[model samples]
Target: MNGVVPHIVQYQGSKRNLAPQILQYMPRKFNRLIEPFAGMAAITIAVAKQNRAKKYIVNDLNEPLIRILNEAIETPDLLIDSYSKVWNEQFLYPEGSVAHFYKVREDFNKGNKCAANMLYLLARCVKGSVRYSSNGMFNQSPDKRRNGTSPKNVASNVSRISSFLKGHVEFMSKDYREVLQIAKPGDIIYMDPPYQGVCTKRDSRYFSGIVFSEFVEAIEKLNQKGIDYIISYDGSCGEKQYGTDLPEHLGLQKILLKAGFSSQSILLGKKELTYEALYISRNLQDSIHFQNTQLSIFDSL
Candidate 1:
């Protein structure tokens, strides 16, 4: 778990906390692991750390994030240099200093993956969120206390990842459905798409507000192909049906996972909200069957 720290630094919607549990359910053996919404690459990184999957294909529609990850994977030295320079200037600017933030963002947005990784650490929210404006720009304002902490050494982080990630990591910005083309049988796909039930303060729509029906259609395609995949979505409303009667009409099973807190309440506003992480799969019945049988055994015992 020590190696899990640096990997956690890069992700905005990281599943690091849930990784151990998720890993428990993963197949005992697999050829490759696919994460289409590789926000922080948390799950994939953990899988890589365990040497569970040889090849990893991680994709996201977020271009800057992808570029940042590529550099973190390919070149560490350059990223370290750039990040060091930025780390020195932390909190020197005023609050609401979008100008300074823009300069920082520009430097991070450069093609260097290492630099991008560093910027991701330096600029992300107090909680490592990458929520942006509706136009898809990084809108996370600067936090005053973001300083004082030891900035992560990109080189060291890269070295850790280099062992398992070099030449094996594939990064891209594309539609999540595109993952289907690259996946083959025996490939385990763990998708963490933008949750339909929640939105950041920025009011930004992630993943184009992925339509429930379209997502179902894509899952159906994966089902027909016998692809092994797990999808994570919103389920906070106690299995509240989504997008017309499709969930019941089409039989999309909802598995509720308590996501973090709501950003609304005054005093506890920043406190984590108990959201849900719904899991949908191609073989919905088999997945449900596994859940039911497991529950039955637990109940009987």
Candidate 2:
């Protein structure tokens, strides 16, 4: 809603485009904002841009992903320089872009980990999406059409992102439950945990998967503690659904944000409309400040 907020990267399952609509549900200001699943921390960036929260906690299970995010925020110079090297190195390969991407993937999987490698991989991966093998390795294929974001643009983005959140935010590579346990009444937690169907069991986009029952229990505890939260859980694209619905016993108020066409579906030659559901905690929806969120959900679509 404000001029486009700077982001570290275009992340798969990141709520980047949907963030503005989501922000309409949040209070204009709060003590803190916590993202437990924090992939690319899109919501955190959005909230920071709006100056909605005094502090932020960006946590994720993927260490490499979190490492790149940290570098973007805390050490922009190093990230840009190293990523530039990683970007330019691809052209030096005898086999061209495809070979370089796999080599980087090989090196990363073999323990040569760094923020630069992770950023380059995320940028060049197909559909900006990530895929991991059951053995916990980076296996996503390169896009092959593009090399990735240039160093100049990356520097600009890192600078802007750092300006918004550098001192105000803390990074964590902890379990979401640990973060949930630390949040207090005055703070707001915006959770975008991996959707169930694809991001659960053996098919996980993350290094780890959340047990649905445990996740539900965690939210239930938050309700008991009087903490306000907004959850981006499950939704459908035309007739194709993504994950299971939250329990009705939790007493959440569901609002559907029409998120337009799914890029993945479009890639598959299906132009399907996608609607992502936002599950608001009971007290949050009842607050006078947040009551109109449902009515304004479509405004940004």
Candidate 3:
């Protein structure tokens, strides 16, 4: 295994730790690996590195995330330059430097190749949390730490990944469900969508109930078409809290997984805690198939 690990931002329900486990349940071979709600894309990157699929499609509704991936994959040189600029101006900026931060965020939002540079800066900000304004602008305050990591000159590795993605990978910023029309049978789709939880006032504008419903619909369609897929989300509550009302309608099996990491939150004088990762699958047949494969492999040894 290549010991190259990219330091990426960890979102609330990131699947960085859950990928290995969930991957074991999917079809062993497929045409492409698709991630609609690719946040930090922990699973997407893991799957790509595993090199099991012929094609890779990583997408997200967040423009900044997409921009970062695009810059890393398509233009490593520009990404390096952008990171250098942020490092050079690191000390000149002040805490909550609205002007400087806004300019960086604006460039990213405007599809600047340098957007990836701003992502690192913003992630290192106040909470390791990305908070944006109502108009879709990053408003997070900067952290005092400077000379943040640049992942060395792994441009060759980045280029290798980009080379594999020239025409193999597709990036999109639309609602994931809408962009799922291209999914077909024998494809492995990994969806890491926003969990059913609260968002701070800063980044609250981006969440959508409608998008969630449509995502369920897309999963159902994929399942019906015999497309192989695995979905990971937050499962802090019991099985009943799997939002039974949602996936049950699709005849999916809600699998509670102790995935990723969790943190406590106290709000409104009440403490409600939950796990960071949760998953739901197609049905009994999929589970049986997975079990049979595992048993067969064990027996072979």
* The best candidate in terms of TM-score: 2
Screening candidate 3 with a backbone cut-off below 3 angstroms (N, C-alpha, C), the clashing residue pairs are: 233-278, 236-275
In angstroms, give how far residue 239 of model 3 lies from its true place. Answer: 10
lDDT by residue (130-206, candidate 1, tens digit) is 65566655556555454423346556666677666878888888888887678888788888766654423234535
Off by over 4 Å in 2: 239-241, 263-270, 288-301
lDDT of 2 by residue, 109-211 (tens): 9998799998999888887787889898899999978888888888998888888888888889999999999999988999998778755486746678888
Best by lDDT: 2
Output the TM-score of candidate 2. Answer: 0.93
Instruction: Give TM per candidate.
Output: 0.75, 0.93, 0.75
Please identify model 1 stretches exceeding 4 Å from their true place: 1-10, 91-99, 106-126, 153-156, 198-207, 237-254, 258-275, 280-301
Give Cα distance to truth, residue 16, candidate 3, Å: 1.4
Backbone clash pairs in model 2 (N, Cα, C under 3 Å; residues 3+ apart or in different chains), count: 0
lDDT of 1 at 20: 63
Q: Where is model 3 poorest over a 10-residue stretch in terms of lDDT?
A: 292-301
Candidate 3 C-alpha lDDT tens digits along 1-301: 3544333443544566656666666655568888887765667666666666788788887766787777767776786666656654645777544456555655656756355555565445655566666776565666655334444444455565555454567778777776677777767777766554432223442432234565667777876877766666545432235333355556654454543222333434444434434344564246446563331212322
